[model samples]
Target chain A: MAPQGQVTSVPDDGLTTRQRRNRPLVIVHTGEMKGKSTAAFGLALRGWNQGWPIGVFQFVKSARWKVGEENALRALGEVHERTGQGAPVDWFKMGSGWSWTQRGPLDDHAAAAAEGWERIKADLAAQTYGLLVLDEFTYVIEWGWVDVEDVVATLAARPGFQHVVITGRRAHPRLVAAADLVVEMTKVKHPMDAGQKGQRGIEW
Target chain B: MAPQGQVTSVPDDGLTTRQRRNRPLVIVHTGEMKGKSTAAFGLALRGWNQGWPIGVFQFVKSARWKVGEENALRALGEVHERTGQGAPVDWFKMGSGWSWTQRGPLDDHAAAAAEGWERIKADLAAQTYGLLVLDEFTYVIEWGWVDVEDVVATLAARPGFQHVVITGRRAHPRLVAAADLVVEMTKVKHPMDAGQKGQRGIEW
Candidate 1:
């Protein structure tokens, strides 16, 4: 066990501390828990504190859904820009409407997601952000809007000091295999089992 | 699938939206994933945005360890106080001395942890904050420094609209049972598996 209550056994990563610091990270947050995206946002927040520009791309959620993280991060970015203390944060989303809706026509959804992926791909090639949050990106691969192999290869070959954090449930095994860090959030209990809907501040 | 990517099957909590809005929550963050503590901090940030007071209690890691989250949260609390945005945040840690070294004398460790838990218990009873982060509280129970049953009962019986967030790996089962929400972070892959140690910005 680690110094804390950690029960999981971590295998040897087999790298020098220097190598670990310099190497870019590909992190996957999957499983059936509530904090995958939130964790990624927290990470982005951390990176923002370090003055690393952040690029957040949402694959499944629509443009209408206003997540609190987006607002908070953007405000942080503004603070950084005005005072040169933190980092800049950019947000983007896909889908036709709110995530609750039908994605605004199934056919259009696929095309829109594809276009979004293309833009992110271009940005990745250009090393747009130090930290790139692919929020809910697994759905695109799961829904066949993007190929898993292509994503795996693209991320593996992405240039510069960029870090990509992907969040979603049921991440493809191949993607997991490529990740330097993969966390599967398991659900033990939830109020939603009792039929409580999502709230504005807490849920969003 | 939830309206979002939430996978937890929350059962009928027998709470109306208003009741839930008013009721304090017991949120447990467990499992082997690296982001357990990070996620809890993220949740705290979310609560901070709502003008909720944040109280963080660390059961492991010395008070000396300078976590990036602590600094960021402290800064955020400052911003909130100055600009009438976000919320206030307080951070505390326990260990023998500072964070980097041993747990002082092994014999005094348990007593120290118990003392720390006592303070947190008092705070919970008083509803000192809207969001109470029992960061790494699981270890105390795992090490027998504190009684899990007592902790669970106290949490279940906590009064007022206080949200408690507990984080660590190998959480006690009874604690999970009493929790309204539990997230188990499963580590699929880690840089530690390759022998790379924790990084400054990413790990802390």
Candidate 2:
């Protein structure tokens, strides 16, 4: 309700205003509503505008599923490459495929999810992306594929200025507690409530 | 929570599934949290991927305020113009001045807000864009600069397949009632709570 970028309270974290303000954020988007992943992608767009390298990791969504954000952002990445305007972008889906694994597509969701977390751990350590979006990652935590404590610890101690945004429903309490910004997307109304199927371009 | 594009129920509105699914939506993002405008901009990116023209109208934010979304989207617009990959994008900020008004930056806030609403009304009636983003528009209604009834009625009567998304906090009840998809962004945590100022690349 306050204007954008207004701080309400200040904690005694032994850091200066500049240090606190410039600290890389861990943002979590959770709840049983829409716009969780969409908003995460939106944040990636902002990061892209800032010439930040972006990495999108989809956990629940299938690799075959082509969302509009992928196309647009990929195109933006291409634009960045061509004109040297923005930064690079990388998108990886952890449903059937793991980019690091030699296997083509895994049948085991749990194994795929675990491997995905391992890759994320390596990326966090390397500080591969300025903005890393873990789309639908909460499900893996809720499903117990990845340890919440590990995630919290890894994110808390991530190297460099990497901003991590995790999105999905039923986010673990520990993850929420560790996050710098947590947004719960509550459904007030939805077309599906009226039995309407998802529309093209709107839903995808 | 359901997979993207999966419908939970079927309505008996006498329309086929395709027709029902393809219906344009009025999405409202409200509540006292971040990512409302961010999510709307994400939707606009999706619309742009579908080759739908996007028009962004910023109501409360000043023209001097240079958000990152504007830069990325405008670049995408240029990409569309050159390669014809995506649709065109137009951004209007109604704070210091109105595009239609010949007069320079107005000193009056109420008059500026009123004129901004008038321009949106005209655009809605004309069906100028496929996706119209009314960014931070809820404040106009809450401030009594624009009538909520007029807004709902105008949006309800909008012709063609235009999808309108309004983003802001404390949305009027009637506006929510008229919206097809309403997302209330509830804040669980924020960096600002710890007295952190907004960061570059992340906040802008």
Candidate 3:
């Protein structure tokens, strides 16, 4: 019941509009020792270039000197430099160097580390970051240092504006299910089995 | 103290020897929107060629026809054709069809269309994939259909050998905390806001 040239359309019920505005939660699961950290660093660099505040966390308890982590942090620093944001110090590096827990009980050490992690988490939550990487966060849960439920509850309650990333080997299944997206990494080949040590800058 | 020249020599500890056996997880979080889905597709394609099993999941309740998913599935089909590994019908034309919660009371029609997500999740956790992608999963949570905790738990419990990726905007902090890498997509300049309708094969 309209003119020949009239374009008939449905009324604008706010449904579609609301859906369009709803943002989602994204989670990437990179498997163990598969350069997931490096890829994460690349994403962080991209986010920083766009002027987003960023934070990085490591949860592995092994306390070994990881070249990959070092390199990722270094790259982030360089990205910041290029963007004229004064170099962001590598807090992990500056902190008490990796403390290998190969000996006796790690009760005290883990407790202290958990405190540090909480502080970092607080800073991350307070800032308006576009991207925040919790490298090896699964280890915190895996090691039973932090309560997984508490972590999940806190994250779920956050504002929709911030993005966070948790990474580590043996991530909790609950964490994966709760995420908006999940990715796993598999390894098919490597050069280290050939009796070669990790090359300085390249491997790191 | 022993003689300087005869000092007990330390073993290499085999850290380097075992390096080859360790496969690191490589996760690439491009962002929530924009080109992330395509970037993930490219990475999955590369991994699939190496004989890696790739899992794809779309969390957005509403399924719009997407050429990217179609093209990626086609590429996968080609791989199956060459490898004689019967093409997985699920790979090609994969999607959930429509938002899980589209206003109005839950109708039988909508419930019927929402079942595909479960199948997709099952495939991801089946342990057959080298890389798994959960696309637009953020919407699932945003729409309040899937419990974020369940998703996170499932993903975390996945075997250590698989690489996983979750993509969408406004990801939960818990998922980010559990992820090895997280990338947030900030909309700097998008053509859609300029009154450009999505183009087939390009925007999809």
DockQ of each: 0.42, 0.68, 0.02
Candidate 3 regions exceeding 4 Å error are: A1-26, A61-107, B1-204
lDDT (tens digit, per residue) of candidate 2 on B68-108: 88888998899899999989999888865866778888777
For model 2, residues A14-129, the per-residue Cα lDDT tens digits are: 77677766998889999888898888888888899888899989897463454789889898899899999888989888765866678788888998999999999999898889
Q: Model 3: C-alpha RMSD to truth?
A: 17.2
Tell me the tens digit of each residue's lDDT in model 1 across A1-204. Answer: 366865465437875546646678999999887899888887876787766789988887554344567666766776776677677788877765323235464457787777777887898999889999998899899999899999999999997778899999989999989999988888888878866565555566
Q: What share of the true interface contacts does each candidate keep?
A: 0.54, 0.83, 0.00
Regions more than 4 Å wrong, model 1: A1-20, A62-66, A96-107, B1-17, B20-22, B62-66, B96-107
**Worst ten in a row by lDDT for model 2 chain A:** A58-67
Highest-scoring model, lDDT: 2
Q: Of the candidates numbered 1 and 2, which has the greater TM-score value?
A: 2
The clash number for model 3 is 60
Q: Which of candidates 1 and 3 is the stronger one according to DockQ?
A: 1
The lDDT ranking, best first, is 2, 1, 3
RMSD for all candidates, in order, please: 8.3, 5.9, 17.2
